[model samples]
Target: MLEVVAVCDAILHSPWLLPVLVVLIAIDGPFPVLPSETLLMSAASVAFGTHNALAVTGLFVAALIGSVAGDFLVFGLGRSSHRVLARATECEGGLSSWVRRHLLLRPGTVLVGARFVPGGRLVSTAAAGRFGLDVPRFLVGSVASSAAWSVYMLLIGLLLGPITGGSPLLSLLAGAVMAVLTAGLFALVQRVRAYRARRALAAAQHPTEPPLVLVAPR
Candidate 1:
């Protein structure tokens, strides 16, 4: 246990930590298995250990830059896929129609809304490229999304660090709980929005049938 704790401490204080964070977050956009949020929160927990404002700021900057870069990278990949294939492939447009209807309809909501959704960021960014969405518009949305995500992750770590007294294990457990709750909340919100959208679409398409009337006696 002592050795394990020692290794964790060394990693938290290591000079390579911040750079590693940037790389992880950058790759996470294309490959989500990396657990970018978990890493960011852990870094925030470490920052809280020092009670230093600069630590939080450093993390925010690194995460933001990494996330934005990754967004553009995936966008490029999508664009290349479309160009090479001469059509929108499944990977590029798999969820795009749904995104356009339920999520991407509004410029401001695209990035911010998708950030909370699972696999949403990947699909949205890729779709932008696949559909040839304007570069400047996509970049603006990406920036907003990445910044919000970084801030939220950092706040989770900072809050849990103090609560758990900087114990890595405890902080991790608490962070996991919070992450789950946040995901569930977002999912619920999405489901409700989707349901409403479906209903509205149905109503618009079908309209209401006129009531039947019988006048045989007359």
Candidate 2:
């Protein structure tokens, strides 16, 4: 493990590493399962320890570009495949409905927030395209989301890296753990919010009936 960490630390400082990192992050949008976040954080950690401003900046730019690029790619897919995809999937309507009702109202907030949720970024971007959200508005939200997400993961890695005395592996592991915990917390909150919304909706639809007067029975 220590040997692996040492090798990673060495590579993180390589001149060609930044560009590769950028590509990985950029394409990760279409592939949410990619370890884009992991790479970003890991690179940030190395940069932090070495005080490499160039590497740090490069990682940030790469991540931001990758995120936005990937989002737009998915957005385009949604536009072209909306009908077919919707017809093919059982949950399409529900997903689209949720995005339209919650995400479209304030596209910027939801876009940034969605990046924190597992599989949410892809869903939100695709929904935005499929549901006819304004392109300019969606792009604006995309920029914000990309910036916030890139900064967040990078910063977490940067903080954790130094604590481990510049151990890339340890920093990456710590950042991953934090990311998982954060995602879980966000999911729990969303569930609670959804439950509350459902309950409120149900109450509004069915008010309690008043009791009939007993004297009328005579």
Candidate 3:
């Protein structure tokens, strides 16, 4: 663990930080394994220790570009797989239908919200492409979400900086834990909403029967 921490610290201070950040975050788009959120935040936390404001700016730029590029890649993949969506859907109102309906109704919402959710970025971006969200709109959403994600991550790091003394490993662990909790909360909220929607649909389809009125004497 100590050795790993030393390595993380070394990498954080390495000259190749920016390039590595770009690569990691870019791949992070399609693959959740390297989403780079915690790494970015840990870097920001180091920024406080290093007291280099310029580094933070550069980090934000790299993260923003990388994440957007990653999302674009996924979007392209989805676009390329038009045949899959071309087939008839199995259900009229399950996840696929819900995604399509929301993407149509609120593309920005879907794109932006998905960025913060674990594994959501790829799914939403792919859905957008598969469902025919145009390039321009996708670009707008990608940029918006990336920028927002970058800012949010920096703030988390900054907030955790004081406690960790800006230690890279500590910050990384803290950021990862925070992100996991946040992602879990987000997933829970979404699940609750879906459950409610399902319940409403079921009720509408088959409402409960009213109490029987036996008024034979009347």
Name the best candidate (by lDDT).
Answer: 3
Candidate 1 residue-wise lDDT, 45-144, digit = tens:
8678668789889899999899999988888888787453223324332245565654435654776777768777787777677667788888889999
TM-score for each prediction?
A: 0.76, 0.77, 0.83
lDDT by residue for model 2 (139-210), tens:
999999999988898778677776756666766666567767877898788788778878888999998899
What's the lDDT for candidate 1?
Answer: 0.74
Residue lDDT tens for model 3, 40-157 = 8888888866677999899899989898888888888787874543332223544446556788678888778767766667677888877788999889988998999989888887
Candidate 2's TM-score: 0.77
Give the clashing pairs for model 3: none
Residue 8 lDDT in candidate 2: 52
Stretches of candidate 2 exceeding 4 Å from the true structure: 1-14, 82-98, 102-106, 205-218
